[model samples]
Target: MKRRFTVSVILSRCSLASSWIFYSEYFYNYQNEGRVEWVYGDGFAHNLNNVNNLVSSLRFVGDEDNWKMDSITLFEFDLFFGIEYYDWTDNTQVPSGMSTVGSLIITGQNYWTVYTSTNFSGNRACLQVQSGQYVGFAADLDEYGIFTVRSYRRGCFGDKKITLNSDQHGFAVKARE
Candidate 1:
């Protein structure tokens, strides 16, 4: 039997017009820092499905524009909610001017609703039961600061992820065989 592994991320920094969210792709027990070819344009939010490439280290690149981290402490990610913060030990959170989007991870048997825009608006999806994965929309992603995850039941992925080939960014939930 096959199992579906999925993961998602946001910029986390508010004002960063562009940024890079890195993930360590893995398979079985082997993994690497970041080998995934990122377009890195306006950035991207992806829900990876079952595949050979699994993201392990989900990190937000804050210094792309060469902005010095003067005294602004990284934004504190909500302990239990949309923000995954995978293996982020050193410094967790971005400066005030920067805020990346976050994914609402679900587990067990609770319903989860995620909005492309905050307050639940513009292109939305939900997971009720079984194994369901929601891939965020690219167009709706421009809202910024609005896609904050609202979950009644969820948790962050420990060390596993699956992604799709995103060009226009579509959604598909595959069943294990």
Candidate 2:
């Protein structure tokens, strides 16, 4: 892990009301290490057993300085199927002892607030995705790197048909239209 993952977000237009960035890769840590920790990288929580801890969340509360009332969305993914890695830089990350994700989390907030488990009956892992991205299931976790998803959680966004996947079996929450 000699490479440094220096991530800095520069909003083309500083407006937080209707804009967001998807979580695909892990952001730099407080120590500014180039290593990847599984807190909230690749739109999924870091390795559940040992994840890249999430320090704080930044929300766009309809203003430039949203610290007053900014709300953060905390999403978690239980990796019971297997450990996976999501690389959005070029979508071609060859990890050592890691499997490729069939789907990716584009962007959104409050995703886990709707979905929780892979299926209603099973609790193999807890599911968490972005609110704005439409996600479905990944047929083969070891094959495709990214794929389009469909909604699985009920009562999400009130069937608003908003745009957003994986067994790699997990649940998803579709955002509002």
Candidate 3:
């Protein structure tokens, strides 16, 4: 019954970092046209000649001089489109066919908090990225009801900064140092 990818930390300067730091991998197909497939850390999506999903364009290599190492990609369908689960650390349960998370993407600098209940508790949403921009895409999160995300973690549990909604795709609620 060891269904983990699990994590449980609530502020107090929550901790959990180190997934083999290495920012900016590679994957291109369309406009970026031609061969270029290089991703370390994590697993899956090595289509090569077949080019599994034929990624049109991609680039989310965390650690732009260290943004908490950066990494977070979860999509089971929505604007981001089906099947994809990447991580950097922190999860109370999520990594087995990925329960449900429609769409979400964030890279570098830090910001993440998703819980529908698990070790992190219930009903919470905060995903940030937009200050010089590294990467931050929500695509669709059911208007913030969150489909089913058991638990998640990265940064921003609360201590100061706040920005719930706005342009360039908003989602912010940071604090914890």
TM-score of each: 0.24, 0.20, 0.26
**Per-model CA lDDT versus the true structure:** 0.27, 0.25, 0.49
Q: What residue pairs clash in candidate 3, if any at all?
A: 6-91, 7-91, 24-61
In model 2, the runs with Cα more than 4 Å from the true position are 1-80, 99-133, 139-177
Minimum summed lDDT over a 10-residue window in model 2 is located at 72-81
- The CA lDDT at 75 in model 3 is 65
User: What TM-score does model 2 achieve against the real structure?
Assistant: 0.20
Question: lDDT winner among the candidates?
Answer: 3
Could you tell me the lDDT of residue 16 within candidate 3? 22
Q: Write the per-residue lDDT of candidate 1 for residues 1-177, one digit (tens) a residue.
A: 322222244332111222223333432112211233222223234444322154444333223232111111121221111223221122222222334433322222333333434334444444332333222122222233334432121222222222212232222222222
142 Cα displacement, candidate 3 (Å): 16
Tell me the lDDT of candidate 2: 0.25
What shift in Å separates residue 68 of candidate 3 from its native position after superposition?
8.0
Candidate 3 global CA lDDT score:
0.49
Residues 1-177 of candidate 3: C-alpha lDDT, one tens digit per residue: 332221122221112221111111132221212322222223222222322243344333334334335677776644444356778788887776776767666666567887778888877776776675545666567755577777789887743342322222221211223
Query: What would you estimate as the lDDT of candidate 1?
Result: 0.27
